[model samples]
Target: MKVTRLSSKGQIIIPKALRAAHNWEAGQEFTAVDVGDGILLKPKKPFPEKTLAQVAGCLKYRGQPKSLDEIEDAIRQGVMEQWHDRVDTRE
Candidate 1:
């Protein structure tokens, strides 16, 4: 078991062994949660959520890639189609 002494300022110095084990560096941010008898320290930053582009790796289509203009046009067309569909459904 590891031991740490609390200073006068209510700060506890994490031991070198524990720091090294957790790859914790000086000035690293952590979230301390009080778990009844003890505190749990966790990193502030978790892994980012996955996105469709990331899952696909690279786009499947081949040939001359669609330019920004083409992509924007496709998005506008899709939105207009959805809007018209909604309008038509309303009678």
Candidate 2:
């Protein structure tokens, strides 16, 4: 177990060894959880936000894929059926 002292400002300087072991950075955000009498400190996960362009080349859209228009039409057809609208299949 590691030992640490609380400063006058109520801040505890995490030990260098523990920080190095965890690869923690100066500005990295962490969460402290109270486990009964003791506490657990862990780094907060970074958000999984990503742009479509970033994931564009990484995805494999396989099988009989439908176009955007086809998907929209399918959705509209489903909605129409739900509303009991007689679908004019002539189009």
Candidate 3:
């Protein structure tokens, strides 16, 4: 296991090996949480926040619209394929 210590400036220097292993770079943002006796650090999401109004219909379909039956068949086939894939992986 690796060890780290908090600095005098209320900052912690994460070890170089662990940093390289996680691909964490300088200025990486993290959210620290108190988990009972120890702290948990999670990387901050790297997405620019957007609302439904801002992103809705951005990927407009340009093809001819399919019937409701076609959509249902596609969904059913996708579910069956996924189920078979999962069952195969369990073996």
Candidate 4:
């Protein structure tokens, strides 16, 4: 077993060997859960896992398909309406 020391900053440095074994890199996110004896470090997922079949056909569209430009315009309009103070420096 590997040993590690917790720094004064309350941060424990995970050993490089274990990190390499798990393919963990810098900036990896983890959720620390306190078990009875110790804390369990679990990798935090950005989003819930879902298969194509599970998410497909979730939104029904009876009308005709929208053009890419039209969809972009709609998104832009929604953003403008929501964030009135937002600046567009690109323009």
* Better structure of 2 and 4 per lDDT: 4
Clashes of each: 0, 0, 0, 0
lDDT of each: 0.87, 0.85, 0.92, 0.90
Better of 2 and 3 by TM-score: 3
What local lDDT does model 4 show for residue 72? 100
lDDT value, residue 42 of candidate 4: 93
The TM-scores of all predictions, comma-separated, are 0.47, 0.51, 0.61, 0.53
Enumerate residue pairs that collide in model 1: none
Score residue 9 of candidate 2 by CA lDDT. 97
Identify the candidate with maximal lDDT. Answer: 3
Model 3 RMSD in angstroms: 3.3
Q: Write the per-residue lDDT of candidate 2 for residues 1-91, one digit (tens) a residue.
A: 8888888998888988988999997997888999999888878889766898888869787788788999999999999886665445533
User: What does candidate 1's lDDT look like per residue over 9-90, in tens digits?
Assistant: 9999888998898898988888899999999988777666678878784747868888999999999999999999999999
lDDT of 2 at 66: 88
Model 3 per-residue lDDT tens digits across residues 15-73: 89988999999999999999999899988889977999999889989999889999999
- In Å, residue 32's CA in model 3 sits off its true spot by 2.8
Cα lDDT, model 4, residue 87? 54
Better of 1 and 2 by lDDT: 1
lDDT of 2 at 75: 100
